[model samples]
Target: MRRFLASALFLSSALPVLAAESKGGFPPFNASTFAGQLFWLALTFGTLYLLMSRVALPRVGAILADREAKIESSLAQASKAQAAAEVEAQGLEQALAKAKANAQAIAQEARSKSAREIDAKRSAVEKELAAKMIAAEASINETKTKAMANVEDIARDAVSAIIEQLSGKAPTAAAVTKAINAARGE
Candidate 1:
C-alpha cells in the first residue's frame, strides 16, 4: 500500500517534465513554465512533509525514546551494583576490625597466663630456698654443740700442762676439774 502511494507521487511529479521536454532548453528558467514548476514543487514538498510527519518521524522518535529509557535503566543498575559493592566493603572492614580486636584479646590472655605461671614458679623456688636455709641452720647448731663439748677437755689439758711446767710435776685430774668448775661459775 505505501509503495503504490510513493509510486503515484513520483509519477505525478514527473509528468510535466516529460510533457515539456521537447520544447525547452531549460524548463525551470522559462517564464511560462515557472508557475507549473513551482506548483509541482509545492505538491511534492507537501506530500513528503506529510509522509515524514505522519509515519517516518514518529518511528524515529519512538526509537530515540527507547534508547533514552535503556540508558536510564543501565545507569540505575550500575548505581545499584556500586551501592552493593560499597556495602560489602564496609562489611569486610568491620570483619577486619573484629579480627584485630580478637587477636589483641588473645595476646593479652597469653601474657597474663605466662605471668601467672612465672609467679607460681618463683614462689616454688622461694619455698625451696627457705627450706634449705632452715636445714643449714640446724646443721650449724649441731656442729656448735660438738665444738663446745671439745672446748672443756681442751681447757683441762692446758691447765695440767701449765702446772706441770711451773712445778716440775703434773696437776691431778681432780684438782684441775675443781679449778675449771670454779673459773666457769659452774
Candidate 2:
C-alpha cells in the first residue's frame, strides 16, 4: 500500500513536466488561418479526446470501479468488527453487574450474621451481670447480719461494766432491762 501511494505521488508530479515539454517553444497557433496551425491543434485535441474516451478512459473507469468495490468491502468488514466488539462489551457489562450484585448480597449476609452474633453475646453478658449483682447483694446482707450480732454482745458488756462502776456492783437482770428500756425511751 505504501509503495503504491509513493508511485502515484511520483506520477502526479511528472504530469506537469510532460505537459510543459509538449508545448515547449511551439509556434503560436493562428486562429485566422483555415487548415493551418489552429486547425491542427483542434484536430490533435479531438483525436486525443476520442482515443482517451474509447480506450484509456474505459480502463481508468474499470480501475476506479475495482477500487471502489475494495473500499466498500473493507468498510463492511470494519462495521462487522465493530458490531462484534459492541456485543462483547455488552456481555462483559452484564457479567460485571451480576458479579457486583452477588458481592453485595454476600456482604449483606455477612453483616446480618455478625449483628446476630453480637446480639447473642450482649444478651449473655447482661445475664451474667445480673447474676453477679444478685450474688454480691446476698454477700453484703450476710456480712451485715454477722456484724449486727457482734454489736449486740459488745453493747451488753459495756453496759454491765458501767453499772458496776456506778453502783459498786453489777446490775441485776431486771435493773439492766429497765436501764436499757429507759435509754431507748420505750
Candidate 3:
C-alpha cells in the first residue's frame, strides 16, 4: 500500500511535465514521432515472431502430430478387428450349413431304415395269415369227407326201416346198397 501511494505521487508529479511536452490529439498521429513509433513497432513484432517460431509453434505442431498418429493407429486396429469378425462369421455360417446337411442325411437314413423294418414285419404277417388259411381249408375238407361216408350208412338204415314198416320185412344189405349207388349217380 505504501508503494502504491508513492508510485501514484510520482506519476502525478510527472503528469504536468508530460502534458507540457505533448501538444497531442493522439501521439501516434503526430508526424514528428512517426519514425520512433515505427522503430518500436518493428522491434516488438520481430520479437513476437521469433518467440512463436522458436518455442510455441513447434510445441503446438508436435501435439497435433501426436494426436493424428493416435487416431491413425486407432483406425487401423478397428479395421483389423472388423476383418477378424467377418472371417469368424463366415466360418460359423459354413459350420451351420454343414450341420444342417448332416441332419438331413440322418433323417433320410432313419426313414429308409424304418420303412425296411415295416416292410419286413408286413411280409412276415402276410405269410402267417396265408399258412393259417391253408390249414383251415384242409380241416374243412377232411370234415366233409367223413360226413359223406356216414351219409351212405344213414340212408341204408332209413330205407331198411321203411321197407320193414310197409311190408313187414327188411330189405337185404346188398339190394339196398345197389339202390343207393344208382340214386347217387355214382
Candidate 4:
C-alpha cells in the first residue's frame, strides 16, 4: 500500500515535467500557460509543505529531541563523574596529609626517644669517668703520702751517715731528726 502511494505521488509530480517536454518549451517561462503552471506549482508546493509539516518534519524534530536528551544525559553523567573524582581526590589529599602528619609525629617520637637514650648513655659514661678520675686522684694522693714519709726517714739516715763519716763517730737519732727538721723550716 505504501509503495502504491509513493508511486502515485511520483507519477503525479512527473506529469507536468512530461507535458512541458512534450510542448517543446519551458512551461514555466511561457506566459501563454501562466495560470495553469501557477496552479500546479501552488498545488505541488502545498502538498510537499503538508507532508513535511505532518510527517517528515515531526519525525526529524523527534529525532533531534532524542539526540538532545541523550547529550544532556551524557553531560550530566560526566558532571557527576567529575564531581565524584574531585571528591575522591580530596579524600586522597586528606589521607595523604594525615599520613604525613602521622609520619612526622612518629619521626618526632623516634627522635625524642633516641635523644633521651643518648643523653642517658652520655650521663652514665660521665658518671663512670668521674668515678674513675676520683679513684685515680685518690691513688695518686696515697702514693704521694707514702713517698713523703719515706723521704723523712731517708733524710735522717743520710744526715747521720754523713756526721759519722766526718767525725769518726755516729750521730744520735734525736740529733739527726732535729737537724733535718730545722733545715726543712718545720
TM-scores for candidates 1 onward, in order:
0.62, 0.51, 0.61, 0.63
lDDT of each: 0.93, 0.86, 0.91, 0.93
Q: What is the C-alpha RMSD of each candidate to the true structure, in Å?
A: 10.2, 14.8, 8.1, 10.4
Clashing pairs in 3: none
Candidate 1 lDDT over residue span 3-115, tens digit each: 99997899788878867775754456578988888899999999999999999999999999999999999999999999999999999999999999999999999999999
By TM-score, who's the top model here?
A: 4
Provide the clash count, candidate 4. Answer: 0
Segments of candidate 1 deviating more than 4 angstroms: 1-54, 164-177
A best-first ranking of the candidates according to their TM-score comes to 4, 1, 3, 2
Write model 2 residue lDDT over 1-186, tens digit each, in one string. Answer: 999999789978887876687653223333345467667989999999999999999999999999999999999999999999999999999999999999999999999999999999999999999999999999999999988878766776788888899889987867776777688789
| Candidate 2 local Cα displacement, residue 128, angstroms | 1.3
Pick out the ten consecutive residues of candidate 3 with the lowest summed lDDT: 20-29
Candidate 2 residue-wise lDDT at 148: 84
Clash pairs detected, candidate 1: none
- Number of clashes recorded per candidate: 0, 0, 0, 0
Candidate 4 minimal-lDDT segment of 10 residues: 20-29
Residue 174 in model 1: shift from native, Å? 5.6
